[model samples]
Target: KRTSLSMGEIMTIDVFVERYKDMESILNDVLEGTGANKKSSNKEQELNSRISGLQKIVSDLEKEKEMIKRVDEARLT
Candidate 1:
C-alpha cells in the first residue's frame, strides 16, 4: 500500500517542533511526581528508574524532531 501527503497538506517543521514541545511538558509533569522520594520507600528507586527510562525516550524523540526539521528544510528546493 502507498499513501502520500498532498503538497497543500504536507506538514512543515512547525508541526514536529510543536509536537516535541508538548511531549516534553507532559513528561515533565509525570516525572516530577514519580521521582525517588514520593511514595512507598521501597519502590521509590524502582519507580524513578522507570521514569528515567521514559526521559531517555523523550530525549530520543527530541533529537529525531530536530532531524525531521532539518530534512524538511532540505527538501524545500
Candidate 2:
C-alpha cells in the first residue's frame, strides 16, 4: 500500500512537529514545577510562611476583640 503526501503538506507537517515539540517541552516544564525555577519555589515557600504568619495574627486579633475595642476607645479619647 502506498500513501502519498505533497511536498508542501510534508513541510507544513515538519513545521507543526517542531512547534508542537516546543509546546510539549513547555508543558512538561509546567507539569514538573519543581525543576523550572528554584527561586520561584523558594519564593512560594516564603509567601506560604508569610501567609501562615498573617493568618496567626488575624486569629489572634479575632480572639482579642475586647482588647481591640478598648484600644479603639482609648485612641478616640
Where does candidate 2 stray beyond 4 Å?
1-3, 34-77
Candidate 2 per-residue lDDT over residues 1-77, each given as its tens digit: 32434447545555655555565555455545743566457655655555455455545544454454566567669
The RMSD of every model to the true structure, in order and in angstroms, is 5.6, 27.3
Q: What's the residue-level lDDT of 44 in candidate 1?
A: 55
lDDT of 1 at 41: 51
TM-score versus the correct structure, for each prediction: 0.48, 0.38
For candidate 1, write residues 1-77 as lDDT tens digits: 32333334335434654665676566566656665346655455655566566567657756765665566677675
Q: Which model scores highest in TM-score?
A: 1
The lowest-lDDT stretch of 10 consecutive residues in candidate 1 is: 1-10
